[model samples]
Target: MKNVIITGTSRGIGLELVKCFAEAGHQVLALSRNSQPVSDLNLKQVTALSFNLAEATDFETVKAYVNTHWKQVDLLIHNAGALVNKPFSELTPADFQNVYTTNVFGVAELTRVLLPNMVKGSHMVTISSMGGIQGSMKFPGLAAYSSSKGAVITLSELLAEEYKDSGIAFNVLALGAVQTEMLEEAFPGYEAPTTAAGMASYIFNFSLTGSTFYNGKVLQVSSSTP
Candidate 1:
């Protein structure tokens, strides 16, 4: 079984992703701001830690865990995201900073620290949004959230190119409206075609084999828009 690291595992898709990996018998490191939900599951071969993307020291916790327990990381899924649903005129500099810190900066910091534990055939999958896609449908209240998602897409593509020879693959999934708490926060009462568990299953499968077929690519995994 592979050693996998998944962030944002307290609820919604992240939580389901943890169940999927654990059921498949892979060693999992589940990270989130609130660790109780995952900890309650008490699944074997799963370690849940309270991790905050905005906190600088949390990245070190992951690095230390890998060094102490699992010497190598087979997959890293950057699934934690922050959202701010406010009009563009009301958006402040701090708003953008907070969103970027969780979505973009955190992804980079965690990946940088974990690179040493990752070897050939390792995969890094980042969960983005369809709103991040250029030329796609745009919404008004997501200026900070959408823009931050867009930034990480480019970041993944750049990393994939830089590490082409290292056998590490980076890819982004621009997901559409999924029935998640975050989606409810963005667009209340709107129903999504996909469920968290459904999307999680897809991601679990992709994390295991997507590196062989694609890298530096952004797949638009959506049937509806915001």
Candidate 2:
């Protein structure tokens, strides 16, 4: 099948995407900051890698991993993100630096380092947020997180345009709220944010469908309930 690289795969949506793709027989390289403890049961096509996204130089590790293991990557998923909520006054420069380090800087750096090895038909999926689309009552201590996601949307759009003629597809998946540790940690007691596994399947299938004429498109997901 396709060869894929998914960031933040130690947990949440990224993890689910890894399992989904591997189950479907695609070779997947899953990267995360923490060693997520894969069962290591000799699953030939799937792998788990741990590296800190908050550091720019860490990308070299990812680059090396791919260069050493695979010849080409058919898809790249930018899903690692950091979100913390606190008053703007209370948020420190370190907070901004950390959030953007993984959200904007790391995402961009990882993609840039891997782009040369991506073929034209390959696709890139970025998980953004509804907070990036339009501000809502959800602005409780989310300035850094929301702003970083907004930057993700813009970056995906620009890349889409830049690669239009190259046949590379760029898509932004704006999720409403996924019930992940990051979400629960940022906003305590919020029921599950969203289903990571289901969303992963839809995105994978969507890209393969010819509907990709809508490349550079934005797809947003949020909890249907409160």
Candidate 3:
């Protein structure tokens, strides 16, 4: 079984991903601000931990735990993100910073801390949004969220190239609207074609086998445009 690490596992896509990996017999380290939902699962394969990605130092706890418990990580999914849906006119600098802190900076810090623990042939997946993909449809209120996710896509590309010799594959999945609390909050009354469980299954399968054939690619996964 693989040693998998996932962030933002309190609910929505992250929570479903934890279930998918844990049920498949992989040892999963699931992190979130509130890990009670994951802990409630009580699955031996899953270790739920509380973490606040906005605080870079919070990753120290994860680093210590991984150093003590796991020799290597087979997969790491950066699934945590923040959405500040507001018109550009109403958005503040702090709003942009907060979104970037959680979506980009936090991922970079966590990945940096965990890099030593990742074995050769390990896979890294960063969950982005279609809103971030260049030339894709754009919405006015998603400026902060979209820009931060866009940054993540570029960061993943750079990391993939830098780590190519290390045999660690990195990829970005620019997801379309998935039925989740975050999506609901971002676009009120809008219907999403994909469910959290469905997206989680796709992500889990990709994490297991994607590194074999794909690296440094940004894939758009969606059935219907939001």
TM-score of each: 0.99, 0.90, 0.98
> Residue by residue across 1-226, what tens digits does model 3's lDDT show?
9999999999999999999998889999999999999999998889998999877677998998888889788899999989988889999999988899899999999989999998789999999999999999998899999999999999999999999999999999999989999998899988898899999999999999999999999999978776
By lDDT, the best candidate is: 1
Across residues 1-226, which tens digit of lDDT does each residue of candidate 1 receive?
9999999999999999999999999999999999999999999999999999988888888999999999999999999999999999999999999999999999999999999888999999999999999999999899999988999999999999999999999999999999999999999999999999999999999999999999999999998877
**How much lDDT does candidate 1 score?**
0.95
Alpha-carbon runs more than 4 Å astray in model 2: 39-42, 135-137, 223-226
| Model 2 per-residue lDDT tens digits across residues 4-51 | 888887777777777777878898887877755443534568877777
Alpha carbon lDDT at 222, candidate 2: 63
Model 3 residue 52 CA deviation (Å) reads 0.6
Candidate 2 similarity to native, TM-score: 0.90
Q: Spell out the clash pairs found in candidate 3.
A: none
The order by descending lDDT is: 1, 3, 2
Q: What lDDT does each candidate get?
A: 0.95, 0.79, 0.92
